[model samples]
Structure formats: structure tokens, C-alpha cells
Target: MDGGNNGGRINVAIDGPAGAGKSTVARRVAEQLGYIYIDTGAMYRAVALAANRAGVLPSDADRLAELVKTVDITLEPGADGQIVRLGGENITTDIRSREVTLKVSEIASHEAVRLRLVEMQRKLAEAKGVVMDGRDIGTHVLPGAEVKVFLVASVQVRALRRYQELSEGELVPLEQLEQEIADRDRSDESREFSPLVRAKDAEVLDSTELTIDQVVAHILDLCRTKTAEAK
Candidate 1:
């Protein structure tokens, strides 16, 4: 929502549905380009996880905002990967848990929650040179981002990927994974606040057949070209 100007540093926005490889590809592309990788999804997940810990329901917007102001959401990189901390506690693993995944859509639909987090997201990119990935980054979060990419893949592929990830840790039937993906997609696209959407000018990348390295390479080329033209 912040329409500020960037004096330097190329901004890249990667918007995609769940299981489309946006996080992994964005991180790789950012790393290759020496840009900061901002995982906007993790930001929301952090908030939802925090709310759950504090016994605040998804609809409790008033307490959520209060908690937001008091909570410290910092992005730190380590040997494992980017660590998202809330109130100085490392909840990186907690954010990606099943509970947060089930409730995040409801929390994300709250306008106040979105506004507060959008402000934080804006601050992260205010320095300009960053690659951010999320559902709405290219549309509502960072409309003026220099490079906007909307990645997509078939629903079957997405479901399979999610199943694979969940199956690694625990038992998740394919049918359950498929239903979960459909449910999340519907919620994300139908949310009232900043619903998942592709920006008008965003270039769409269908990764149904493309490998992770291929996707990263393609995005890197587009980012480099766009950054050069902006200068």
C-alpha cells in the first residue's frame, strides 16, 4: 500500500499460489543476485502463530493488533535458512505447522491485521533491493515493485508437492492433501482483504514442468533486465 520511491536497489515481487515453489525459487534468485530475500508468507504465518500462542482467535482483530505492536518479527538468516522470530522467540518451525496453515487464511482476511503487516512489509522493502514472495506482493503489497512475477502450476502438481512435504514428516493421504490445497486456494482467492491475485503487468510463470533451478534462472534473467532498464 505504500507508494514510495526507491532511490536504489532493484525490487522483485513473486506472487504465487501454495506449492508453486515461490519461496524456494525466490530465495535462490535473490541469493544469486545478492539481494535480500523477504518471505512475506512467513510474516503472516508468524502473526498467526503468535495469535494462537496468546489464545487469540482469528477474529480477534483488536487483540491481534495490540499483540502485533508488542511482538518483534525479525528476519534473520542462519545455517539452516531464514529464521522468523516473534517476540525474540524462534517460531520458524511453528509457523509452518498444520494449525497455523489452517487458521492463517482467516487471520489474513482481517483488514487491520493486513494493514499492520503491510506497513512492516513496506519497511522491509523501503531500502529497495529485495526479492519478496507472497500471495499478494505484486498486487496490493508492493504494486510498484520493479520486477513482478506470478508463478503458477497445475493443482494436481501442487497437491502432490504438498503431499510429498507432509508425508516426509508424517502420514498425509493424497486425498487429504488434495482437499487441503483446494480449501486453501479457495480461501486465499476469496478473501476480502488483498485476495490472492496476479498483478496486471506481472509476467506469469507456469512451473508445472519447470525445475526449481530453471524457474530461478528464468526469474533472475527477468530481474536483471528490468533492473537495468529502470536505471
Candidate 2:
């Protein structure tokens, strides 16, 4: 997009914990604004998926870093949403599987892995007009982004959101899902490299009591305001 006459496109950075609706809200906001939506988390998950397939454990940081260098992960805007490709193989669905979910944080926590993917993310946003979302997008991936948002929600609410999205066959117990989400939060917050954190300039948004549409609308409003100010 041409930034609506400002002569420069705005880069939007969105960071949040799992199940805070970062992916969905960022996608819709980008669609409405005619900007590219980059799901940074999926990049890490693609790595995790590859590592899992190769029997590379998360504890093997050196091996995982090597694995990341060997694989080519690409994201393209698809008809439905962003399509994630690893080593030229479409793995949009595989990365979202429960197995990947349990291991992505470990893979993402490695300093080398984060360094490699962060470079890719920066390159993708160099031209601007991109809405990138992930645990550390605002803090590390696109620190100079024009607009930054930190989305949050209560643990209970977050778990429910995830359960609803991933539920199909036999339901996973709500309590179990809650614990899993909680565990992920702990790991994300305590990780040595690029641990989940709110950017100092980011606008904190609590979605605990808000719907997906509500959250997206709020972010769109913020983007509009920021872009208008720039003009």
C-alpha cells in the first residue's frame, strides 16, 4: 500500500502471548489496510516442524541452528491467509499441529535460531507496509515499526480461545489446555534469548473481555491514528 499519500508505508509490529488472537487480528488488520501480514511465529514453528521430523531435539541448540540454516522458510499471502513453506514444502497446517506447538518455544529460544529468523523478518519489513505479529515482533523483530501493539488476555480466556480454534474431534480438557497455555507463558517469559516482552513504546491492549472483531477494530483505529499523525 502507498501509505495513503504519506509517501511511505507504515510498518506495524504486534506482540503477544499465545491465544491472545495476535495472528487473526493482525491478518484482518493487514487485509483491511491493504498491507502484507507477516506471521513471525510461524517462521519459528516451521523450524520446529523440520527439527521434529529430523529427530533433532530442542536441547540441541547447535544442531537446531544448523538445521535452520539448511532450511528455507517462506511466507506468501494465500487466498485464505498466509501460507508457510519450509524448504519449499507447504507446511502451513503441519506447523500448527499440537506437536509443533509444544516445541516451537524451545526452538525459538535458541539465540542462533532467533538471530537467523529475526534477520529474515527485518528484510521482509524493510519496504514497510507490513503487519508482523509474534511474541517478540515489537521488541526485537521490528523495533522501529511505526505502530506497535502488545495484546494480552487472561489465562482462562486465552485457553478458551485456543481450545475453540483447535477443537475438532475429542476435546482436550479445559483444565489441561489451561495448564499448557500457562506453561508456555512461563517458558516464553523466562527464555534467555528474546523472551516475550512488551516493547517500551507499544500500546498495551488487554483482550480479556474483547472479541476478535473488537480487538481488530481497535488496532485498526490505532494504525489509522498513527499513520494520520505521520502525514
Q: Estimate each model's TM-score.
A: 0.93, 0.95
lDDT of 2 by residue, 75-94 (tens): 99999999999878999988
Error of 1 at 135 (Å): 1.0
After superposition, the stretches of candidate 2 with alpha carbons farther than 4 Å from their true spots are: 1-6
Per-residue error for 67 in candidate 2, Å, reads 0.5
Alpha carbon deviation, residue 231, candidate 2 (Å): 1.7
Error of 1 at 211 (Å): 0.3
Task: Estimate every model's Cα lDDT from 0 to 1.
Answer: 0.87, 0.90
For candidate 1, write residues 90-186 as lDDT tens digits. 8888898888988888888888888888898998887787899999999998998989999999888998988777736667788887788888899
- For all candidates, what are the clash counts? 0, 0
In lDDT terms, how accurate is model 2? 0.90
